[model samples]
Target: MNITTIGFDADDTLWHNERFYVLTQERFADLLADYTDRASLDARLQAAERRNIGHYGYGIKGFVLSMIETAVDVTDARVPAAVIRRILEIGQEMLRHPIELLPDAHKTVAAMAASRHRLVLITKGDLLDQERKLAESGLWEYFDAVEIVSEKSAAVYRRIFNRHGDGPERAMMVGNSMKSDVLPAIEAGAWAVHVPFELVWALESAPAPTGHERYRVLDGLGGLKALVDWIG
Candidate 1:
């Protein structure tokens, strides 16, 4: 492993993110408890999320819209106006929630930056929301470049590698989602380190990589510094 540049995924990888979504979903379920059961509401909301990903993309805004859509569908379009108002409130609350860094995220990132590795943040979501989180996290200064993309794919990784990095062989992506961060970086010819988060969005879940030369998995960010040191 001769990695020179390292890219990080911003959401659950670097901070507590999906937990807020889960919390809001629970609130959403409670708000519409009369319309359906928890299991049924969860399924319908997931369905709505999948359907709206193309139109709204991923973020609190999209999640809020999905909740509203699910509410309308489950209630046969009779969802109370107050419920809709509450749903909007949920979205606003999520947007306003404080950015909580995951355990060792700050230390590990600082170590990587101190080691002179070129660091880039590659995350996908609403631009304003993502920017706000980055600003609040106070880790923005560590990154040499920040990319808020519509989606994470091989092409996207390739472009980032070409522009900010020496190329795939010299680049590594560290993140939580195998589907978004690890796999695509590998597909783009870069090394990838998977740092699994306890709660992952169903949309971002995928099978772990096995026996891949450029792929490695660590229990958490605690191992990130040593891994990058070894790679360097």
Candidate 2:
């Protein structure tokens, strides 16, 4: 089947998302500086994030909670209230940070939209935060659909593509994460395109589907529209 629907992942894929977390993590390291060194602190925080994701899901809130958990752990529950306050403030700063669209993000989505393909924003994060980002992004109108999911799996991809387009066979999932966006979408029988961002979070990291025919990688989103045309 010809690809008629395209799934775009938000966060680092469309705009500057991971960079915020990178900055906030730096702050987290600072907040816990007296408790542990940077290397150890980073490892602990990553461990915390991995554990908390199942409970808190994903987004600024969960990230903040993970930071708090890490802080408490490294300090053996002796973490000062002031340090916790600063952590909360850090999260608020992130939530209020302005969305900066990645290079070619707008043009590529517009081109794909104009070409008459159904463009769906498929992302997993806090619902209100994701909605807020989309509203401020100014690319909202270009999307034929928007899915704010708690997670992305083969079943979710199949259901989304089938509902929003023809089916997984006629859809393409485009994003930066190999784990969340690529592997599962391909497993669901859709084309999966990996467009790398500068910074990939540890949790989102996965081995590329190296030899899969359905998998494709672009240097960036600039080449995406042409590739979609070629695929069609």
Model 1, CA-based lDDT:
0.92
Question: Cα miss at 19, model 2 (Å)?
Answer: 1.0
Among residues 3 or more apart in sequence or in different chains, the pairs in candidate 2 whose N, CA or C atoms overlap within 3 Å are none
TM-score of each: 0.98, 0.98
| lDDT tens digits by residue: candidate 2, 123-159 | 9999999999999999999999999999999999999
Computed on alpha carbons, the lDDT of every model, listed in order, comes to: 0.92, 0.94
Number of backbone collisions per candidate: 0, 0
What TM-score does candidate 2 get on C-alpha atoms? Answer: 0.98
Model 1 scores a TM of 0.98
RMSD of 2: 0.7
Error of 2 at 164 (Å): 0.4
